[model samples]
Target: MVTLDKDLASIQEVRDLLNAAKTAQQTLATMSQEQINKICEAMAQAAYDNREKLAKMANEETGFGIWQDKVVKNSFASKFVWDYIKDMKTVGILKEDNEKKIIDVAVPVGVIAGLIPSTNPTSTVIYKALIALKAGNGIVFSPHPNALNAILETIKIISVAAESAGCPKGAIGCMMKPTMQGTAELMKHQDTSLILATGGSAMVKAAYSSGTPAIGVGPGNGPAYIEKSADIPLAVKRILDSKTFDNGTICASEQSIIAETSNKTAVVAELKRQGAYFLSTEESAKLEKYIMRANGSMNPQIVGKSVQAIAQLTGLTVPASARVLIAEETRVGHKVPYSREKLAPILAFYTVDNWEEACELSMEILYQEGAGHTMMIHSQDDRIIRAFGLKKPVSRVLVNTPGALGGIGATTNMAPALTLGCGAVGGSSTSDNISPENLFNVRRIAYGVRELEELRETPAPYTETASINEDLLVDTLVERILAKLQ
Candidate 1:
């Protein structure tokens, strides 16, 4: 309810925050690994401890997503980040050498400026702050106006742990108030060595194009396709769980469903079983036009409405218990506002007669909202999944699971995260979930040709006679051996 004046914080305030972050980065560089781990653990514990409070804050502030699901999101950010970086060596001295020759090292990238979104405010607040700390970098946060209070409070909790662990004061600094101009200032600040940006297209674009280097995430228009081979019932159950969770505020949540005509009936039945209510043809036609703008953009008013609420918005009557509002098969690229990430439990369905049609329509739907985001297909057919993955123009193609949670595990078994990086077409550099590893840098030590022998003086490539000549060879022989030396 508190609206921040754009001028609440001036240029001087931004300067102070930057100075503190720089000091914190230096402090981190001098800290021991034990100190780093202690601080990280404290952050993880604080997130877990305040899960309920954090969820409440997010729901009340954003008026989007369910509270319980936000709890899971916050907990995931804390625990997953800690586990991902636990074994990662970022502290003290990490030296790769030939026997003992210095090769590559791990170096922190100075100060990081992070932009937290309204959708997953507290989770991202903790996640970005912790990752920067893990990398021995100081961090500054620009919270979305909708979730500023939640973000600032979370930062306070983390600052306590960081300072107690001997981290330099101001290691984790955030603006008491943020504005369009203020955020732009932070992004362009020379003191901010790195930008970790998440949110709308304009913000991400600014971060990427700002002379400073940044890791930017794009918008998500994840589409779920169900082929003939899929278990219609199971797919429906999983899709409903993913779509309805947190009122579909997640960027990776399923935006559209493409199912085979043969399985449409069965899928719809299961969807109903999972608390979804299917609308009549007339109802869908009315809602479709109502939810979308003439230009095809989603109407913001419908962004986070519940299934039943959306039904009412279209002049239909559905029980309050309904978790998902289903609109029957529509043409590909149909401009229904409902398909454009309502951020709610409303699902737009498309039925195709053949796999090719399904693929084509699924890609079209994804392109409509997320040209470079994520698409998922639930099927046992590797060929189908492979086809979708290779051809959809989407950054990520998840198989057999919902786009929101399952897509995060596309490259690793890491916990399903809230932040997804929609790639180029989707207007992002990443095609997968953003993780802490992205925040760190890998410093390489290249030796001059003359220095190569000296660098590897003590290390023998191969013990055999043939090996000696092999080691002398460049491409595979030398490079492979050097790679193994690490």
Candidate 2:
């Protein structure tokens, strides 16, 4: 692990960074939109040029996610800068009419303090840093211990680019060593204007309670519900593709399945065809005993391993290409660790009698870990899908694709994001997929009620006098009526 003199950079260092950032923000905000676009284009190109190197750094430092997947994540992050904000104009006040009515405009919040997760360190660092820069804010990152190297390396890349582009010299900074205390100091520091937290529940909570406004997200326990109407074979293929992607380290990956009973057998068979090895009841029990703690915390060693790797742990031999290991879910709750976030290639399947049952089971399982995360469904019936969306407590309900890829925008039309906001129900402030645009505010133009005569002729009923004390009239009317009746 890298070491730094913690006492040296203290809270004061963050303050100094903020001061420089504010000056740069003013400069960038004053610059033409053309300049910002040029930087974004350059960023996208840099991301493409260095994708391989960034991916390798993530894999070596985090030791959890795969390199190829990290590459995709970095590319998405880089491209998203263009996708979400490339066309947006944030430099000058937008005007609707010559009535001195200027629309809303975004101003950089000075300094941003971000907590980068170990799961997607490199991508998160790049995404947050670039978005902050684009919004004309200065940023500092506290990388998770598992990904310190990748985080630092990415910082160097971004800082060099920004400085070369004539941005502020210290527009971006990162801690050389990030400890628990160091993180606490950063979040609670007075100069840190906002906290963009992406990680576990504990860190999100800390950010929220740090006496600053924060955008926090909760844990993801994504549940995929397969209605009887879904194509059993296609659904099976999508599920396997999702679960085994990056060995299931994705937070949006399906943690449990609620398959309609009529399709369970067919789905299981197709899953077998797609490189899944089902364990016998006895073997599943033994594997459970060895792979999880009594409290259901996954054994870290088994979390991101492939199915073949997990099978080898249980003295079972599987083909080299086996994508996922499976076991029948006889019951529910924390006792069945696989039904929760195993964060590996193991899957648990539960059978339901009907669509309603499937929805209930899926929501129940998600409520256990998802809370505010998301629920996924596959069915041709739009009404049924809408019903699930309306009834479920989940924040973002996805349909007709693998939970992992669909939720993160890989195989769907939705925005590609690494951060899936688990809304307040799940203890998160965000309820949509994370995007660079979320980091900034949109300016709106409002015209005064100039047409008071037209407003009076409108449908809404209101006494529109040139000067009306509505409150005084209500009180006077009440008194007059009471006096007359007396």
Candidate 3:
């Protein structure tokens, strides 16, 4: 008896899944909007029913984030995402502009290669599956190895529900034995129509380089700016709420706070009152060492960790009630840990002279790392809010809301999604909160509204050019006569 190598077996598994997904996608592409909606509804309900179970499994398996928060994320991914996309027309004739004599037809992009991250594995799987199937596309997941079990379990639940609702068999699948080679095969597969990649920068880059069209997201280093006119206590509350939610596991959470100088003291007092521990200069330096790896990427060990856990890991002492740790900083760069994205219950504090300077600092922070991701501002002044909206480089400029919840559309009117596209500035293809609309292509049926004569000048019967040629002959003769005379 012979056994296949682990990598080889994984690669073979990917090929098999791709073959199945291809056939499944063909069937899905032929499905009507109602049929797709029924399958999506069933999958969403199943995921919602198993939300707590999957959330606990994710937390236990990956040892990241709060289980209760994971439950919220799961519910958001399942219920909120489905509700948002349930009524969207994604098949057949989507729209017809009789006045303009044009028709818009929705076409599924076909088989999708979904890359799930370890941070929000279950929720991401649910969200991806919902949007993919809602848009009439089949999905094959490449689960992060650390959260493979949870992701696989979620997929299994959804797959069963989907099939029972008339979804094609094998339409939803995950790589049980995930490997780099397997993921590469999945992304580069001939049958894979598009890649919905939501993970680290390196993985997104790999997906973009796989010679396949991909919608990949980038890292988020969102800064929450509290203008002087804002309510300092309420601003601090929202920022803390965002930073501490899921121990800051969500990439869109606030990474730092930029407060105006006039309100800096008040903001600090409010932050402290809300259980944010301000680190001393020495302690700040100590914690900086753990924020990022030696290679300059964020250290996974500190990601999704609580304030107490981060303090213990960095050998610092903090109050037991502290929900977040803050470090004062003035610089923004690759070497500046506090100025970068810390996916934990930690934040960097900066003071600017006024809103103008705050805007400048926000742009500097985003440009340093998380351009085209998200930013937030707590401002009662509409002018200030509009200014930040116009000047910020980020895709989502959340106002007076927790960056984590607002950026993910949980507390805002944006599309509910787990995969947030960072747009061109962040090297992504889109800047929208990814949705089922993004998963399908639109084919335009345009009528000929004008005749070729409308584009032409009726040729003027060639009389105008005929006169010019005739006049040229006369002028040539006169010039020749003049030349001979001279």
**Can you give the TM-score per candidate against the true fold?**
0.85, 0.86, 0.94
lDDT of the structure predicted as candidate 2: 0.75
Sorted by lDDT (best first), the order is 3, 1, 2
Which should have the higher lDDT, number 2 or number 3? 3
Regions of candidate 2 where Cα sits further than 4 Å from its true position? 1-16, 94-102, 290-296, 313-316, 442-486
Clashes of each: 4, 3, 0
Off by over 4 Å in 3: 458-486
Candidates, ranked, TM-score: 3, 2, 1
What is the overall TM-score of model 3 with all chains considered together? Answer: 0.94
Q: How accurate locally, in lDDT, is each candidate?
A: 0.76, 0.75, 0.93
Q: Model 2, range 1-486, lDDT digits (tens) per residue?
A: 856467555545555655666566667666666776666566566665677798898887656757887787787777754576667655445335556665676656767888898877888787787777766667788888888888888888867776766666666888775677778878888778888898876798899999987888776777778888887788778888788776787778887777777888888888888888777888777777756766556676776676766777777777887888777885667666766777787778788899888777877787777788777888888889989998898877878788877877777777676777777788777787766556666667776756768766856456565566879889989999999999
